[model samples]
Structure formats: C-alpha cells, structure tokens
Target: MEFIILVASSFTKLLDPVVLAYVIAGFIIGTIFSAIPGLTATLALALLLPLTYSLDVTIALMACASIYMAGMCGGSITATTINIPGAPSSMMTALDGYPLQKQGKGALALGHAAIGSMAGGAIGAMLLIGLAPFIAEASLLVQTTGKFSLLAFAMVVIVIAQRGKVIKAAMAACIGLMLATIGLDAMEPVTRFTFGFSSLTAGIDLMPVIIGTFAISEILMQAGAAKEDRKMTEAMSAVKIRRRDFIPPLSSIREIGLACYIKSSLIGYSVGTLPGAGGSMGSFLAYVETVRTSPNPESYGKGNPKGIAASESANNAVCGGALVPMLTFGIPGDPITAIMLGVLVINGIQPGPQLMAGQADLIAPVLASLLFSAVVLIPLTLFLLGPYFIKIVSIRKDILYGSIALLAVVGSYVATYSTFQMMMALVLGVLAYYMRKNDFPVVTMLLGFILGPNLEEFLRRSLALSNGNPMTFFTSLDSLFFVILTLVFVYFLAIKKPLQKPTGAAQSA
Candidate 1:
C-alpha cells in the first residue's frame, strides 16, 4: 500500500507543466542533435549535464531520458535521407532505409520507423517497471571473468555477422584490435604501439576515425560516381502509410506488435544492461535475430518493412533499458549512460540501493516522468516532424559533401587540435574506403576497436584474482556459458554453406 501511494504520488507529480516542457524540449533538441553528423547522444547529454545542476532532480532525469530516446529515433533521419548514419545504432537501418529512400519510399520507411520506435520504447519502459529486480539481480552476478567471456563471444558474433568475405572480416577485426593497442597497455604501464610521439600517448579518439571512415569515405566514393548517378531530381512528395502498410493484413497488430516489442525490448535490455554494450549492439543483435527468424529471411537487405522495424525498435528500446543499471547501480551501462551517471554524481545523487532507499521520492518521480515522455513523443513525431524530414533528399550532393568534409575536419581537430589526428583520420579514411570496396565490414572492425582494451583489462583482473591460474577464467558459470556459446557459433559457421553473393538488392553500393 505504501509503494502504491509512492508511485501514484509520483505519477501525479509527473503531470506538472514545467517538467513536461523540459522533457519535450529534450526530445526536440535530441532529435536535432542526433540528426547531424559528428554529434552523438553521449556528447549531447554531456553538454546538457551541467545545465541540469540548477534544476530539480526530476527535471534532470526527464531531460536525460527524453534526449536518450529522441537521439535513437533521430538517427533514422540521416540514415534515410543521406545514406550516412547519425548514430552507431542507425548503421543497421542504413542496410535497408537508404535503399528504400533511393527507390522513393522514404516517407513510408520513416513511418515504419516511427511506429516501431514508439512500440519499442513502451516495451522497454514496461520491462523497467516489471523486471527491475530481476535485471538488478542478474547484473550483480556478472564479474570480471564473466565480462571477458561475454566480450569474447561478442567479438565472435560480430565477425560472423559481417556481410562479405570471412577472411576480409577477420582482417578488419585484426586492424581494429591493432588500433586499440596503440595506447598504454591496459595492465602494464609500458606503451605498446605509440612511437614516442606525445600525441600518440593519448591514442586516437574513435569518433573522429569513425566519422572519417563512414562520412568522408562516402564523399570520396560519390566523387568517383558518374554525374548522372549523382543527380537528385526526385521531388519530395508525401507517401501515404495506410494502416495496412505497417500492420500487414496477414499479421495482426496484436501478433506483430507483441513479437517486435518483446524481442526488441529483451534484446535492448540484455545488451543495454551490460556494462559496455550500447544501442548499436542491441540494434545489431535484434536485426540478426529478426532475419534468422523471419519467414522470408532473404528480404532483410531489400526494402523489407520488418527488417527496418526490428532495427529501429531495438535501438530506441535501449534508452530506457540502459538507464536501469545506471540509476539502480552506480555503474554506467553504455556511453550515454556514462554521461548521465556523471550528471547524477555532480548533482549529489549517488546511485545504488542506498540512494534508492534514501532518494525514493526523487527516483520515483523521474521514472514516472520518463513514461510520460514516451506518451508525449508519439504525437509530436507522427504529426509534426515526420512529414518535414522527407524533403531532405532534395538537398544537393555537392553542397552536402562539402559540409560533411568541413564537419569531419572540425570534429577531428576538436578532440586534441593536433595535425597528427587529422592526418590519422585521413589515413584511416583511405584504408576504410579500400576495405569497403573489397567487401570487408567496417562495423566488425569498430567492434574490435571498442572492445579490445576492455577485454585486456578484464582478462588481467580475472587472472590476478585467480593467482595466475589460466583455468580460473572458466570457473564462473557465466564465463563457461559464453565459451560454449562461442564454440557453438563457430561450429555453425564452419558447417554452414558458403555465402553466395546476391547480385541484386543485397549488394551494397
């Protein structure tokens, strides 16, 4: 009865106009922030974290939650209009969204994305409410050895998920791993890849490299295409999305909605609750599972509505899911959650069980506020912004290319103001271009680059705990499960028929 009163009171407080306005503002700002190149949800949240100092904790949490959800949805704008992904999570969307846009189905695709996003957010929020205790319990048991094993399994899955030649994928992972080794060794103080240059000590920032690889390479590739291919003559016309289009006649909203929401929510929560896994990992896994389970798996890279739906849904779901561990425990679940955690600490709201008990008033109101934001974003997205964004395809390519190049230079230099970093970005861009042309997946490389340092750090910690016993790594149930999972995946890959490159729609431009 006491808990019910607390929640009811919190829900009443969530109806305040001031709290409502701030959350709406966060949604708009996050949408625009993530729609642009070179800006990410983490950076956007971090920039706003200081401002939250003056506000109430409820307002601060509302701002963070709204921004996180809107940012995930905002990535679809670039994915559909420009063939570039504004966020890492949007990369999977590009597999079909861009293709559909080129085929003049941009408006239709955006509608699907919007609907999927709403469903996913609702599911994730519901899970937060209903399964919080269970998730918290699971998180507590994940030790260093378990984390390392999970990372290893993630790497293997990522490699297998690549679109092209297995050998090329392996090479890309190697490159990413090698890039990760450039800074100081994780356990030992000895520098490994730095060649005595002071700039090398800081190592390369991943975002600049990613921007150059995907954005800059797109520009270069476009420059080489025939002028006829570069033409943008298509008018931005509204495409009607009848109820029939989104919820197919054969698939009821009850069935499709439940499947998309549950699968995406679970994937998002499982991956998002993990210490370092983020929206991208969740989106990627959801997409792969959708493909594997779909009745027509071959339709994935085509203009398949279900494929687009799965990726969009899972990525947005990660926002609420990622927040669970961050608010309940003191640990950051993903990069965006890390920034949000910093904000909480700065506001003197230390998270964990003690904070939950001591600060129930504050925490309850914030969670209630978040559920309200989801309600607010739906109409705002469907009625207002959905129609306006389709016109982005009318923009000229030359101007677009020039603007992207400028942003790439500025974004890279902003990190350290080093000429060496700019030079490195260009070098990486060139390598990435060649790698793509030869059928290697850049995302596989990105996974390895992001995970390599953490993998080393965790391995060292686990070893130290075991007193140099290598076998101790597999002692944990979580570690053993992951090891077995990795082996099973590898065995499947070995026995699976050789990949036959499809000539038509599945081919990347």
Candidate 2:
C-alpha cells in the first residue's frame, strides 16, 4: 500500500503541461521513425539520448516510455498499407495485414491493430507497475555467484535463440565482449585492449556504438538496396484510408473474442521477460497459438483480422515485459530498453533492487506515461493520423537517409563534444554494416558489451569469496538455480526440436 502511494504521488509531480507535451511529441517522433522501413524506436531513442542531458530526468523518462510504446504500434501502419513491416516486430502483422490491404480493408486491419495494441500495452503496463516492486525484492536474494550465472544464462539463451544461426550469434557476442574489454580493467588499474590511443582509456561510449550499429549501418544498408526494392507497389496506390474506416466493427471484435486479446497479451509479456526474446518472438508465438486454435485456420492468409490481433497485442505487450528486468535487475531485454537503460544511467540513477523504492519519483512518471500512451494515445494517434499514413511512408529515401546520417553524426558528437567519437561512430558503423550483411546478430553483441563488465566482476568476486574453488558455484543454491535454468534453456533452444504443427497460412510458410 505504501509503495502504491509512493508511485501515485510520483504521478502528481508529472502532471505539468510541458511534461505532457514532451511525451506526446516523443510518441509522434517514435511513430514516424518506426513507420519508415529499416528504422525503429531504438533509433529514435538513440537520437534523443543526447537531448536527455538538457531535459529534466522525469520528462526524459516519460518521453522514452511513450516513444517505446508508440514504436510497437506504428510498425503496423506500413505492414498493412505497403506490405513492409517498418519494425521487425511487425513481421507477423504483415502476413495477415498485407492480405487485408489487398482485399481493400487495409484501414480496418489497422483499426484492429490499434485495439490490440491498446489492450496489450495497457495490460502490460499494469503488470509491470504492479509486479516490479515485488520482483525487485525477490531479486535481492541472488548474490555475486548467482549474478554471474544469471548473466551467463542471458548470454547463452540470447545466442541460442537465433535458431539456425546460433554459431553466428555466438561469434557476434564474443566480439562484443572483446570490445568491452578495450577500456581500463575492471579490478586492476591497467587497460586490456586500448591499442595505444590516449582517448581509448575511457573506451567506447555507448552512444557511438548504438548510432554506428543501428543508425549508420541502416543508412549504409539502405544506400546499397536495389532500386526495385525501394519502389512503391501497385497495391499501395489502390487503397485509400478515411476517418470512418478506423472504427472496428463489433462482429469482427466478437470473432476474435476478448480471450484472444488477453491471451496474446500474456504471451507477449511473458516473452518480453526473457533475454533476447524480443517483440518478434512474442508476436510469433501468439500468432502461432492463434492459428493452432482457430476453427477456420485456412482463412488466415486470405485476410483474417484475428492474426492482426495476435500480432499487435503480443508485440505491444512486450513494452511492459521488457522493463521488468531492466528496472529491477538492470538487465535489458531488448535494444529499446537497453537505450532506455542508458537514459536512466545518464540521469545519474543506477538501476537495481533499490531503484524503485528509492527513486519512485523518477520511475513512476515513466510507467504512467507508458500506460497512458498505450491506453489513450495509441487509438488517438491512429485515428487522427491514419488518413495520412500512406503519404507519410512514401517519402524519398535519399532525403530521409541523409537527414538520419546528419542526426547520427551530430548525436555522437553532442554526447561529449568529441570529434573522435563522431569518427568512431562511422568506423563502428562500417563494421556493423558488414556484420549485418553477413547475417551476424549485432544485438547479442551489444548485449555482450553491456553485460561483459558485470559478468567479469561478479565471476571474479565469486571466485575470490570461494578461495578459487569452482565447485562453490554448484554448491550455492541460488547460483545452482541459474546454472540449471541455463541448461534447461540450452536443452530447449539447441537440443530439443519443436513438434511441427502446420495449419492455416502457416501451412504454406
């Protein structure tokens, strides 16, 4: 009750009109960034990170939360209209959404997406707000040895989750860990891999790494795309969305049922809690479940709205689920939250078990903004802005990519006013471009970089406590739990083959 009161009190302080404006603007920006192909909310947050320095911490956090929520919702726009998923999370949405668009019900599909996003995001935010405090308390039981195992679990699970490309994922993660070891050593006063540059003492700043990896690499990727790939399809010119088309019919909602929305939301939220298991996974699992249970499964690819419901609801729900470990355990579930974590760190707040109780004032507004964005702004933005989406997504690539390149370089420089960092952004961007071109997963690498320092610190501390006895890890109950958990994940991810059940549109896929 006291914790609830503390959180509620935090909201009152954020009731300022200016703060609300920032949240609204941030959502709009996130939607725009995510609606365009090859862009994401992660990129929007990366661009805004430098600005967080000037903005109040509460306002910055609120903006980030809203942006993250909007990112999930915005991707459905392009998926329905252009048959292109603006964000990776919307891939499942495209399977049904594009077919609906071809049937001239594109606007209706988007409306279903809006409804699903609202329900999922609202439920997810509620879960996050209600459960984080308790989870934080439970997390305190794990000490140094357990912490090491947990991080190792995150790394191994993320790597194996790549399915067919596990080897590539592992290699990428190793590169990240190696990069993390470039700066001053964690325990000793010596550096490990500076390679003789004086400025390398502090190592690479996260802003440069993120900008180079996502923003700059995207620019490079887009630049090299075949001309035919960038052209608008004939179907995009055929459909026109109006204000009235944004309201979903009652019969269609009944067809999907409240149960479908609720179940999909739960799936997304659950998947979001796992490391490297992102929105795409949440939506994919939800969509798979929907197809498996539906009475007329074959109608899915032809133009069924239920698929849209499963995809949007599950992906949007991921917003709340991804935050659980980030706020309580300081571990990022995905790149968007990773950037949001940077926002918290940049504001001089350290995340962990004590963060919620100690910094309720700072955390509460972010949660409130997330819930508000999901429940209110999602439908509102879709309705007000739906008419113009087709036009907005049709902007020329040259202008769009050019502007992004300028922002990427400027953001890197603005972080510390160092030209070296700006140059480093390009260097790292080129490296990431080739890595992506070769099908390597950069996200695991980024996670590796983020988790490497802590993993090393905790491992060393645990070994010291046990007088260098490796058996102490297995002997400790908390550590043993994580070790066993990792093994289970390995069994499921690498060793165990899934039972293939084909139905509906998935039959062809």
Candidate 3:
C-alpha cells in the first residue's frame, strides 16, 4: 500500500512544470544526439552532467532518465535511414534497417523501431520497479569473489560473441584492460602509468576514449568514404519517403508478434541487470536469439521488420534494466549509468539499498520519468518527427559530416576543459580508424576499458580478503556458479560449437 502511494505521488510530480519541461528538453536533446552519426547518448549525458550541478536533484535525475530512454530509441532513426548507427546499441538495427532504407522502406523501418522501443521500454520499466528489491537482495549475497567472477563471465561472453573475430576481439579487450591500468592503482596511492605527466595521474577519462573511438573514428571513416566516392549525394536524392509512408502496416506488427517483443525485452532486462553488461550486448544477444527462433530466419539482415523490432526493443529496454544495479547496489551496468552515478553523488545522494528506504521521493520521480519518457517516445518519433527524420538521409554528406566532426571535437574538449583530451581523442580516433580497416572489433576495447577496473579491483579485493588463497573463489557458491558458467559459455561459444561444424557437414555429405 505504501508502495502504491509512492508510485502515485511520483506520477503526480511529473505534472510539475519544471520537471515536465526538463523531461521534454532531455528527450529532444537525446533524440538529436542519437540521430546524428558520431554523437551518442553517452556523449549527451556526459555533457549534461556538469550542467546538472546547478539544477534541482529531482529534476536533474528526471532529465537524465528521459535522455537515456530517448537516446536508446533515437539511434534507430539514423541506423535505418543512413546505414550508420548513431550509437553502438543500434549496430544490430543497422544490419536490417539500412537494407530496408535501400528498398525505400525507411519510414516503415523507423515506425517499427519506434513501436518496438515503446513496448520494450514500458515492459523494462515495469520489471525494474517490480524486481529491483528482490534483485538487490540477491546481489547482497555476492562477495568480492562473486563480483569478480560475474564480471569475468560478462567479458568472456562478450569476446566469444564476436564469433569469427574472436582473436581480434580478445586483442582489443586486452588493449582496453591495459589502457584502464593507466590511472592510479585502485588499492594504493601509486600511479603506474602516469609517464611523468600531471594529467596522466588523474587517468584517461572514459569520455575522451568514447568520443575518440566512436565519434572521431566514425567521422574519419565517413570522410575517407566520401573522398573515395562522391556519388552519395546522387544516391541519397534517389530515395524518396513521404509522410504517409511513416506509419507501419498492421501486418508488420502481426509478423513480429507480441511474444518476440516480450522475449527480447526480457533478455535485455536480464542482461542489463548484470553490472557492466550493456545495451549493445543486450541488443546483439536479443537479435541473435530472435533470428535463431524465427521461422523465417533467412529474412533477417535483409530488410526484415522483425529484425528492426527485435534490436530496437532490446536496446531501449536496457535503459530501465541498467538502472536496477545502479539504483539498488550503486553499481553501474554500463558507462552511461556510470555518469548517472556521478549525478547522484553530486546531489549528495548515495545509491544503494538504503536509497529507496530514505530517498523514495527522489527515486520515485526518476522512475516516473523513465516511464513517461517511454510513453512519449512513440508519438514523438512516429508523428511529430518521423518525416523530418526520413529527410535526414537526403542531407548532403559534406554538411552532415562537417557538423558532426565539429560537435565531436567541441563536446570532447568541453567535458574535461583540457586540450590534452582533444589530442588524446584525435590519437585514439586515428588508432580506431586503422583498427576498423583491419577488422579489429573496437567495441570490445571499450567494453574492456569500462569493465577492467572493476574486475581488477574485485579480484584484488577477493584475494586480499582470503589472504591470497586462490580457493577463495571456489568456496563461495555464488562465485563458483559464475566461474562454472564462464567455462560453459567458452565451451559453447568457442569450442563445442566450432567442433560440431565438421561433424554436421560430414553427416550431411
């Protein structure tokens, strides 16, 4: 009953003009950031973090939550229209979405993506609200060893998921882990990778790496492509989309089916609840599962509406799922939530089990904002901005790429107010460009960088707790489960699955 009242009050708070205005503003800003290639929701949130220092805590939280939800949905807009995903999470969306655009079904693809995002976001929010307490309680059972094991499991799964590119993925992850060690040691005051620089002691910020690897690298790649082929303008102008074409047919809905949305959202929510497992992984896993279970699997990666639905639904759902660990355990599920954690700290609010007990008022409003944002996304994308989004693809390459490059540079520098960061971004951008050309998976590097510190800290802490006894990990049931799970994933993803290929071929022959 008390919970019911809190939820009701939370909804009422959304009616406040200040909160509503921020929510709307955040949604709009997030949409624009996510729609533009080389700009991401993470960059938007990072830029917005400093500004939050001057705002009311509740309003700030609401705005961040709204932006997170909107940004996840926004990525699909460009992914469908231009073949370039605005965010990493939408990479899977681009697989099917861009092909649909080539077929002049860009509007239909966007509509399906928006609808899927709405359903997934709503369902994920409900799950977050309902399961948070239980998940938090369960999380308490995990010790340092268990935590370390869990992060290891996530990393292993991510590496194995790259399939044929596993070696490159592993190398990229190793580079990220090495990069993460550049800052001060987690347990001691010693700075290992400073290399005699003041800025190095503070460590390489995630913002610069993120912007460099994704935004700057993307800009360089686009520039190179434009130089090689000047026909983009002619090609874009050939595809035409009408406002009336924006509405998805009922057949699409029926074909994708309600079950697929629910299943993909559940997958996203589950993945998001794990610390450091992010939306990109969630969406990729969900899309893979969708194709595996789909009766018409051949239709995937070929302008299939179900593919767009599955990818968008899973990625958007990750927003709510990601908050579970952040709110309940003070553990960020991804880089974006890590920034949100900073927001909480700046506002003198510590996130953990006690957050709900003592600060239900503030937490309630944030949760309400997530739900409201999801509800608003559908109408905003499909009705208000759908036609404009379709026209985005028709814009000249020079203007679009030029503007994005400027934004990426400005945004990276402003985050730290340091010229060093700008240089670092350019350096990483060049490195990423070469890596991309060589087929190395850059996303793995980012994931490794994000999770590496946590993994190292947890492992060191666990060993220290047990007096350096390696058996400590095996002693705990929770830790043992994850360690065993990691092995199973390796077997399925790296060994057994590969070994079965020749056997199957021989049998078929």
lDDT of 3 by residue, 187-300 (tens): 899998788988888777776787777778877877776353334445445556577877788987998899999999999888777655578778887888888898887788
| Steric clashes per prediction | 0, 0, 0
Question: How far in Å is the alpha carbon of 147 misplaced in model 2?
Answer: 0.9
Model 3 clash pairs are: none
Which candidate number maximizes lDDT? 2
lDDT of 2: 0.86
Per-candidate TM-scores read 0.63, 0.96, 0.78
**Looking at model 1, which ten-residue stretch has the lowest summed lDDT?**
239-248
Q: Which regions of candidate 2 are displaced past 4 Å?
A: 227-230, 233-235, 499-509
Instruction: Give the Å error, residue 91, model 3.
Output: 6.4
Tell me which of candidates 1 and 2 scores higher on lDDT: 2
TM-score winner among the candidates?
A: 2
Query: Quick one: RMSD of model 2?
Result: 1.9
Candidate 2, residue 131: how far the Cα is off, in Å = 1.0
Error of 3 at 205 (Å): 3.4
Off by over 4 Å in 3: 1-8, 36-61, 78-109, 227-232, 238-257, 271-308, 322-364, 393-407, 410-417, 424-434, 496-509
Output the better candidate (1/3) by TM-score: 3
Ranking, TM-score, top scorer first: 2, 3, 1
Ranking by lDDT: 2, 3, 1
